[model samples]
Target: MRGELSLVADCKVVRFDAAFDITRETIGAISDVTLARRDAVTAMRRAFAELNGADVPIICLLRNTSENGLRDAKNLGATCCLSAHTPPAMVARTMMTQVIQDRADRPVRSIERGVARATEVLTRLFDGARSNGPVALAQVDASLEPIIEAVRDGGLTRWLDRVWTHDDATYQHCLLVAGVAAKFSLHLGFSASDRNHFVRAALLHDLGKARIPLAILNKPGRLDEGEMTVMRTHPVIGYEKLKAAGCDALTLGAVRHHHEMLDGSGYPDRLSGDSIGDTVRLMTICDIYSALTEKRAYKPAMPNAVAMAILSDMKGRLEDRLVQSFGEAMGNGS
Candidate 1:
């Protein structure tokens, strides 16, 4: 039966008689499960108990499709209960459709959890900064781990799609930058430690914005020259706050210079090429992409192609190589 199903669908079919055969890897790899056993309900209960909170669709192929038996199966997480005599082709087709639908629906099911956790942590962190309390770097790491894992499991496109819906402009942009930076670091195959540094910098890059007045920070229109000056001070403001909190120099540099351009055209500090380190350069790319693609009250969200084109046009200001790499990293080719 497993061999017949495998031939019909492009999926790995694992056969198990009982719940004892399940493992963590099994849970991670499976999109759908088939229970072809005499004690189907008993097996499903044990299987789901071992699965913990992992969400995988289950199909039951039982000898008896009695109403009570089907009810028990449905209550135990089975999506469909069919007689054991069902054809392999029909079962395979049903399983394939379920797998495809599951992937399509994953963003809605998975990303919300990660986004909520990240938002809770950011709210606490920004509020702490506003109150002049010590920044808890450990807590920030704990919060972002779920987000990173979500992006890894669900893909960057889905993560961005959900993040763009957030109502708070400041928190939305921070989350966007963090998600993009996490994906970028993973795309570039950065070491775990280095990736953590990039993500941490992205998350806290706008820490100083907490101090900015609501009128200016949440302005419905573009900032005028005076307001622009205040906005540009955020990098330095963030740098000072994080520095005082004992942040390492690498993170401090990225936080302070994420806006700095390769040609000394950026704000707070006009440090030119080579003077800008790789960490700052990468963070700048993620920051710009997130900002441009984000929808705002005053300006509509720029399309990804348009944003990438603008980055490409900045021949002198941004690092051309990194810009191209960032486009590829975002699944939008340079």
Candidate 2:
């Protein structure tokens, strides 16, 4: 039965002498549906739910389909609906394409869903801050739970390896920064609580950017002096917002100082050297790396080697120890 189920997972023309019987036998298998009647969709959905595969994409074939057929396909999470008269090879090709596409899209969809949830939390925080209402740290913790879980589960690298962005650069950028920051923290011997705090700071480091105008935020080209000045206030803005919401000192420090350079050249306070602590230094490295690697309307993303080289060149601006640490963690042969 398991071998038969394996065959079904790979089959382009899936058939069931009796839909209920076959579905009962094929738990945990993803199969193309070359044949299904109106009632079959509901039965399949039930079976898929039982198999813990409710979201699995099913390819449906029918002699003729009405609006109800389409609705049924949607309910069953069908990937495509094909005419029964379609040639076997064509059906096979179509099913294969859908299977490949579904596999590719899963990670992307996961990122999108995660980003959307995180954005909702940020939006609410921004709205509350604007109104000067009390915001709870518990809410922030709840909002970060999914991101923290993904990072801890060793899934962050899988998400980052896929070169795509579903939301604005800010949301995607923050998520990547947190992942990198968490990774760096692990390498630097941070305890679990310390790592979570580090990741939280990375997540909210750009909250101040929300106060900046959208015009400047999304601009593809260079900003003039005035716009640049406006752009640099994000760290302070983020810090104040988190502080008002009762975030801890570490988070506040990272949010405010992530942009501060070691050479007294950064924005807001512009403190240099030891004034910027190790946590901020770690955040800065991750923040810079994520920003450089991300695609923007004005510039294509640089390769990792190129970005690392650029970071290495700015030795005085960034901490040498942290840069070396980051490079070690992220280095490949190139």
Candidate 3:
């Protein structure tokens, strides 16, 4: 009751214009409705009354709801009963759409605040190294904790979508890569230690980009040879930066070699297929996929199918077996 009261009252709203799982008694969402406690139902009634008869747009998970609870929910204004299996992102999207439809206003600023804070942290990490020298490696890990936690917590990808902004492509790209890499690592049956190493690498793979000028990085036009040459140095630069900060060999390898191709055509080392380790190969696949799918000033975002096709065509560049594995894991088939 206190939780609901505080949320509804503190927000100065009568109706809690959000979806929640009754079973969990937590706001934002619940996975099961049938498991909702009787006390929770009573609390909902009190919350509605506190709104002075305003219709609360309570969202319930229908699959778990008992018939009695259903009666109570309808009486208490739980007008939207979503499927229990609906992804939280989908639920948020659906609720937001309905809230907008009903002319209910909710502030999206909170989500934006989180993204803004993350962007600020990344900006500082990048800028600090440039102006002052090496920031503590621990600080780097701490700064990235929220994003890592969000990915681990599940449904964060969808939640992130609710709050996504176009403010910083670099930060967004890193987050996306981390999430995607984590999923891929899981698919490949990577041990927890190895997965952690992989995720950290994905997050910091573009650390060298911090040194690159924004003009070239954000350029809408194709890079000239000189600009391309400069851009290609990011891997080496990142490798040096992380190495200076005392990151492990696996992490450093990922940061430096993510750009290396299997055909001996890659830069900084040009190590061919056999020379590239499994981890680097994995990082390469993640890096290429993330880059291809991302929208840039110079190009539009490609569809997943197109991106996979291009990856497939890069037989000499990326490991073919890993590419096939990636496609299979992504449900597109190799």
Candidate 4:
């Protein structure tokens, strides 16, 4: 809601079908609209309310409504209209197009999901690393297998790559990290356990970034000295948060030292070379690549090729072998 007015908002494509989902207050010509249909007036109120202040134009897809609905929507202030019979997949494309045309916010709504599902299961396992809980590890193994296979055959990674482009800072960064880490692991010929390790580490590497003030993290320009110091502390902040939570060792290391480079130039302990754990090294590569490629709250994304070259140039700054592996992986597939 705030992004369009305040930050780098994608074009907004609100699903109008759920107008009455909140209040059967949903009425009007959109009753038959099944895909995203709920109530028309409710949809209008929410959409207009959001678009009222945002400079970005609204794209209202009315594919689910009747002819009367169309007239009603226009009368009510819908900008564009489509038939209820419009293909959902195509609707998705249209919404994305609208966002690109205006360079407004993305069409996806914030699906408020609680920390449940198997991802949480894995999170719990890594969270309680000291327990040596095989249960969490086993669940993760079973769950990640399909994900690994998908990426190997070029499924999950591609999907992650696609969605990563349009998500919020945290979601986008995590996906970017997951993709790069998976590719790095595959290139390293890691076993399933090692592969899962990279996946977990990459995904959760900056979970603590969620705790940082958005103002600091999303600063479009260069950070001033104090802000820079605060930003640098994210690793320690995330690390301590995890430590206090009693997370697993590898997970803790991932959150703590993903910023630390093989060269002493990294942060926190400033440990260089072999002192930094291998998992952290891999995550460092993932973190850098993902950040460079993903769009930020401040600006558009950097091209993959350009990002890769930068990483390559930073070889001496990171683990030389890890960089080589990462480069090779990128060259081989994506």
Highest lDDT: give the candidate number. 1
Q: Which stretches of candidate 4 lie over 4 Å from their true place?
A: 1-143
Candidate 1 has a TM-score of 0.73
lDDT of 2 by residue, 29-73 (tens): 333443355455556666555434423455556554888766765
Name the better of 1 and 2 by lDDT.
Answer: 1
TM-score of 4: 0.56
Clashing pairs in 3: 21-29, 21-30, 34-64, 34-65
Ranking by TM-score: 1, 2, 3, 4
TM-score of each: 0.73, 0.64, 0.62, 0.56
Candidate 4 lDDT over 1-334, as tens digits, reads 2233223322232355443222222111112223234465665666555453242434455544777766766665555566656665554455546556543221111110111222454455444542433323345444454445545655333635454554356656665567667767888899988898778666667755655677887677788998888888778766775566556898888888888877788888898887887778878888998778777556776766788889989966787777777877877653
Q: What lDDT tens digits, residue by residue, belong to model 1 across residues 75-102?
A: 7766666677878777776766766776
Pairwise lDDT winner, candidates 3 and 4: 3
Whole-model Cα lDDT of every candidate shown, in order? 0.77, 0.67, 0.65, 0.60
Q: Assess candidate 4 and give its lDDT.
A: 0.60
Clashes of each: 0, 0, 4, 15
How many pairs of residues in model 3 come into backbone collision? 4
